[model samples]
Target: MKQIFTLGTLAAACIIACAPAVADTATQPTASAGATSAASTSESRKLNKLADEYWDALARFDPVSAGESGDNRYADQIGMSIAPKNRAHQFALYRDYLKRLHTIRRDGLAQRDQTSYDILDYELTTALRFEPFPEHLLPLNQMDALPVTLANYSSGQQAQPLATVKDYRAYLNRLTQLGPWIDQAIANMREGMKTGVVQPKAVMVAALPQFKQLVAAKAEDSIYYTPVKNFPSGFSDADKKKLAAAYRSTIAGRLNPALKRLADFVEHDYLPACRTSTGWSALPHGMDWYLARVASQTTTDLQPEQIHQIGLKEVARIQGEYARIGPKMGYNGPASGLPTWVSEQAKYKPFKTEGEIIDVYRKLNAQLQTKLPALFSLRPKTPLDLRLEPELSRATASDHYTPPAADGSRPGVFWSVVNDPTEYGSTGMVTLFLHEGQPGHHFHIALMQELGLPDFRKFGGNNAFTEGWALYAETLGTEMGLYDKPEDWFGHLNDEMLRAVRLVVDTGMHAKGWTREQSIQYMRETLGYTEAAARNATERYMAWPAQALGYKIGALKIQELRARAEKELGPKFSLPKFHEIVLGEGTLPLALLEKKVDRWIAESK
Candidate 1:
């Protein structure tokens, strides 16, 4: 959930999938170099140590990662913000580390270490881009930020443990940083304004409540009170009393007032004054900047127009598949217009209770696992579970993936509907399950973490590779035999169409200057979605302009690569090997992926 605030992209750092140990460094070339020259060996060890230090620094800033990895160096560190100055210092440290990493020759590392080094190098380079943009000027977006996350943290059943007074104190430290962070955010937004880079009015309006909620009403009622309310029985009375007072005072005096300032600035000052244009192209030299983003995210030099066209072709192909399912669902015409039929499917209606919806996904997961090995070879070790979005966030949240902690203590979680299940069409479940669950995110992400990749590769990722692989997994449903049900097969196609629509609409909004309503109308008319579904989906596109474009764009490149690999390898082609090659690389841009796949094909031949 990387948020596009007025300043920085709030790249919500999801927990990287966890592992059993320090990833068997005994096998790392730097750790065991019997054959390398002494100079190479010495340089190799130094580079490896720098790599470890990079992970340590990241985990320290990212409290969730530290807690998940079972690292106690930051155990008492909670609810803290990496100050703007500190963040700049962090960037400088990483730059210095990258220089050290480059000093070591790649030939000195093991095969595994080589891959780790390549991925780390990419992360360091990409991270350097953020330094140019002072994003801390505006940190918390209503859509995704600390306030929203803290509410989630307060729910007893999440990433951080809140059983002890120490945990409460950790949060207090983090929470206290908010006041200063918001001030910094304002400064950053002003900077953006100076450069004509402020967030779209739509984005700011959507985020207003986040500020209001964080600072709303009484201190006792704020979400920053779970530790005060749920302290462990063994806690001393003095610690408990003192922690409760911190929570109360922070919320009443500090948190609420900060929220008021932010909300008023957004709702009253920002939104009304927002730029009407949507695309990054609307900004000064935005076209070149967006092109860079496309290249960086997709890992390819493919032009935006080429991506736009691929989306068109895929949407049509999927639409044909949808037509076949329409009649079966009681529609009169070819199933091709299945979005309409899907909307009419009464059984697929929204749910009255959240528990019932979550339970059904859980059931589907169990049933699928029983059947998955028949078609797929990998699975996530993090126990997949269902959880509800916090009440405050439900209204804005979308179903999301929360990766397992570094210690494998928590399983990869597939968050379901933001609120009620009934809002989305029933036919979408198969496609949704395919993209987010089995053989999709769970397989690509979880399995990579298990393969002993460096921390950078495990925790940091590119959207195109990750999302593209999930969409590619959707087309594999027939191979798994689960799509034998016509409705389910149609469901998969509908999902594909949904992604295709994203490319057209996302490009239309940002690049083509299509209005928000126009995008909504286009999706509704073409995708067979209702007003609510259409609006929700479109707003998502508006909220994140280029991200939705990743799924179809990435998926097409992957499918194209597979066909080429199969054609080249011929009788040597192996699905498991193809999958292994794809997942084994962690996350690379689509173009980089093709290069890797081509190399794999050559090696297999």
Candidate 2:
């Protein structure tokens, strides 16, 4: 199923549920407290059973998640997460679950069972901590607005199924269901305005066209019109005609008006009232919210200032590396000028067609496949595909990977943002593939799903491990022979530099009260981001605090672990074995990961 909490879900992402739900295992009671007692073992099993039931209930309540999980039982249900009543009920469920979990004796469980208990407890508590905040009021970001994701779903081109008559009807149900939710979304934003918890005007402005596109003047113009035009082959003409008529009526009558209402609300009301300040600290309890986000995203208690210092050190190191390679690229300047020179260099962007861009990705895949055996013994059996982002969503879409369907119907897909060919630089393509495709998300996410682990462990992830492993994967370019040339190496380092800059800038904006302009200027000066790119990147961090920090922080930790394993194991160190241990258990918090690596080291020795 899609992530029970998607990285794109505005409410979840805003509340930090998208991050790894890790808690203080020491303070919380675990079955290990029972010291191998039979009662403890029984309690652990009971808790496991309860955890499964909890997930099953959660999956049922979240329709998009249900469909993504490869379960179609709740395909017809569309949840109104932004509604006040819905939030209240969800919070109630979380409390009830936590209460039930606490009743279970954690003192007698085994190590594995204890870990599961801690994870579940953490997930529930992390979820509960946000209940006091009015995050639902600011549910739409430029990047992950509910309307945009719904449009993709209703279009029958995404995770939503459209194989049969029932599937078509299911989507129709979903569209009808979304109308009230969209209405509630507007109402929530209205509440946000009153409480000063609304999204920034810049973010709201970015979201304007997305809502406008959904509110088509003609039924045929609507994204929802896609299903009617492409009926299933097995559908009889009578059935197709009836469904088409129903869809057109639904689009024109219910959906179009609902979307128009939302579009008007956003443009006329929300936009003007949206906050001008970019930082979260500008809002009520904004600093605390940002702090919570930092802790959740990094899975650490490191303060923003500490992370900022770390970022500065990392930026300095990466700049030194970038400077060393400057003369090779025909530039002889100080490290500080490298970003500007890279921005000015036109030779880096070579692809003239969408085909040319995709060709490079496919070639990169082929190259990585051949070199896989040297570093990774456990490669994903699930196939990976490279495809362009749909033209409609290309405006906001960035290069990303979609994990394979849990049931294996869909292969892992690497979606390239090929909107404008000239804008697409060839220099970063190798590093991009390394991070998003093979041995990156495609490898890490698929392996978790492939293993018959607990539902939470399989699909649930912390941003740090998920993004960290991918960034760390970029560093693997050297070992895999992908970054052989200076340009390719430059691409890798340039991307690394951006992640480091994220540390400085994300904290600078939220904690230090840096203006949006200041953050954008820093990105352009330090990381070679273009003006447009800098604004977009800065806005993303503004929309979601501490999330950008995950890439560099995660990558550094993984690299550190690898170095420790290598140094301690000496000749006994096995690259493939080390990889197996790191990735075998799917995503973990950095602390747990370090412990796992330490254990592997001791065992190897």
Candidate 3:
């Protein structure tokens, strides 16, 4: 419903992209109503059409996302990146969609239709605001571990399949598009730099290895050729030969050269210019920009100062919980005063091999499943798994979660970085699983799709509500009885420390003008992270700026609300029903979420 900074020349193009409202979730957004103005119906229909266009476009935008979700429409369309022209077109569609959505008198629509329209408006506008900001251009970043996304395609278990002759061709097309995309990515980054919008120095360092891996000389040596070695059975020899040749040419002639260009630019030019500060505030209008992002992420009108204060309040409350547990564990303060106990904690060691690390997580995930029903009435229908973060992308990557496709073809995954397990700190596994796997991201995201809501809301998430949910899930271990064990309780504390530290350091860097070193130091002192992990997180902050601020600020709000509901509902409060209330509407702006929950609680009473 709100507008982002307009794209001047591309503004018209963006208007069309904006028209779809909620692309993935809104196709069947609402119940149809009888008797409306012909013009109003036409506009509503136009907005609805975006659901189809968005899937078609999204399948194009990220073929892996499409294939993983079992939408075979894009199954064969891989190897091509989004053409800027498509972006220009979508931009216009989105802008116009927003305009048309507003013109309708919302209350005139049926209840379901009205709600769908509200959600559609929010998702479309968020997409529009995000589009022209060069995010479309710089697709490869340290975040998703881009190189790993490629490696997983080769790994056979992930989204990009190794099934058909058609599948191989799909990848070839993907390879063909890589070089041009890289060029576009670099051009965009450079352009961003012109406006003081450069990535943090830490992120630039992370991008280097991806370039090096892709630029390798022989086609077989490249990760793309990996699947070529283990092709699916029953393929014709001639087709194999043809596929192999096409891949070799694409990798050697197109992909490798592009990598060389990017690597050379990164090591030789871009790194030097990367900003030393970790916050988005370093960019032009950076403060205003971060505030907008915070708003978008949380889906709320809370200002940065409000979120910051909320973060402080939540940190103190969590510390009290930690204090109650610390004496039982033989530690007194929330501060054992860093070094001695921090390093000496037995769980703070590394895995000897990558397999061991992956195995540990697999075991933990399985452990949780056996106990899940006692605490959660709602869970993901999708299966869950743990995988090693691919070696090629581990240097700059962190542990992450990738939710299953709506169709259930690909299982939700918890990927751990095996780059240097010692650096990762072993103590956080249980808490991490709850956040990324069990009651955290996987459940939240998967259920959004399962709910009978507009597709727009189904697939969309507010960062504050989403990540906040994960962080809050970390604390739920106690209620589930998992935290009765001292070690698991410690894991919860360690994770909370990480998020609380994020509040202090993320604010310190962007708001208070702390240097990158200062931010890293603050984390090291507070979070019990290794120096290396601290460095990685600080750099991530530099690139993403205020994104780190969302977790604690968000989780605290949910925890507070839950407490309020419990006291008010008293004997009548049902945890399962309460959870349904929290998740039932899908992710909303925090304010909307609170209002909706208040209504539910009042009616339940």
Candidate 4:
């Protein structure tokens, strides 16, 4: 899942009390040296205090985010985030934070605090810059939406805790608010219809099934009743009975009806009104919107045309790799036909049950764990759990990771979406495990939480750093000797090709006005995705602009930085140390990451 950055609850008082304050004399030039030092120290203290306050306020504003981060203090609340008044209040909060941040002297902050200052300034500025756009009008999409997210939570195995009686009641309270949230979503879409900011017709058509499936005939059959079926061991029969009754009531009385209403409304009202054109460029001020998304998602200044060209070059380069390796795999065919040829190989589709598919990932994890110490000196303390993606969400979901609870009550989970084990291929398992499980998200995210970074840095992430690091992790498979087999190597390259194709296809659609069919065909030919797979991937880009671009763009940047480090440091460069430098500061924007690496090289020299 993409990282959600709503407000979270941290102990503001404790954070402010324990935070260190130090001075830099650069900004207070007119004062005497001692006076400058004191002034700088005071300003630094104030900035730290403000950072804590901001985190606390965010938790109150978006309790679901807070709960996801393991702050159960707000577990009972689910705020109306998309409502106009709430959105105005949220934007006003951003403005206030920005105005206050401008009062601080960045030059006067100590080096560590300066990084915090810059990050906060960038975040607040970005939020306010997007204020003019009515993102609330289009609340949900096929790729991601509140309903899908909440459904995942209702399973009791996701971010929402269901370990105790209080946990159960907290979820019940959260469900009570979903009805109003749905009502507000309908209202927002109505507003969007008037403003010409609605979702495209194709996007809505793909999203319809998600809502429709939630409308079960009885509350007992609803996904929200999942928790009741699997009560914790210690719960008394009386408590279980009461909780189950409460769940059935809430699901029947509040949740199911809201879902049915949403499904009906989308099928009847919203689908017809949705735009026929697939590109974001078709909407009002859409080119600007797409540009902003490109900048924000990649955290780079590269224009869409530049990115598009880079993608085209990358596609050609990866195809060359395929040609060189194809003959080794007993396929003397052209590079374009390699993936299709591999797909037809019976040996690759060996799994017959979900258990067998998961066991491959387990075995991969165990094999990779022994090899990790050679490359990474720093690793996360958090344990990772492997599981199948819940049946309700598997259709639309992809393989992904969810972070462990901040309190350590829950372990990080890698969910593999296996809709059909018979059709599931085994070639991607090794690289997939590397990217979504160990040493990738599990290591990067869990280690960040363990490092005791500031609340904002701990819970927040940008796609470039997070997704880029995962893609980079996939390349490590070659070094670890996991891709020794011809078929395994093909799998790794095929996955890489998908990311490369994303660059070409995402930009082609959003910036160059490529049609949905064009995007689907490009993916099918380049990556050997089946027609269904290709269509699903195409609609994903349509629903989420600039998101797919992050994997390749981010991975390339990290690779570039690694290459520079190797050349500059020579024998002195340590692979583990280089990784430490990259992953040490949590999820930084690409520019900040580059600066950090450059500084490390200079210091080591």
Overall lDDT per candidate, in order of appearance = 0.65, 0.78, 0.64, 0.81
The candidate that wins on lDDT is: 4
- Which ranges of candidate 2 are over 4 A from the true structure? 1-41, 65-73, 105-107
Q: What is the TM-score of each candidate against the true structure?
A: 0.86, 0.93, 0.84, 0.93
TM-score, cand. 2? 0.93
RMSD from true fold, candidate 3 = 5.6
lDDT of 2 by residue, 1-605 (tens): 12223432322422244234344334445344346587776787789787877666566556676555445567787777667777777778778888999888775665566667766776677677677777778777776666677677654546777778998988888888778878888888888888888888998787788788777879987888887877778899999988888888888888889888988999999999988898988989989888877877786778899999999998899888887988888889888787677757788877689999998888888877788888998888889988888776676667888777776667888888888898677778899888999889888988888777687667566778888899999888898777878888888988888899999999999999899999999887887677888998888888877878878888889999999999999988999999998898777777677767887788678
RMSD of 1: 5.2
**Ranking of all candidate structures by their TM-score, best first:** 4, 2, 1, 3
Per-residue C-alpha lDDT of model 3 across residues 353-456, encoded as one tens digit per residue: 77777787788777788777766687767777777776654654567776666656567777787776554556567888889877888778777777765554
Model 3 stretches with alpha carbons more than 4 Å out: 1-47, 54-87, 103-105, 108-110, 128-141, 144-148, 193-195, 316-324, 332-340, 347-367, 387-397, 416-426
The candidates, ranked best first by lDDT, are 4, 2, 1, 3
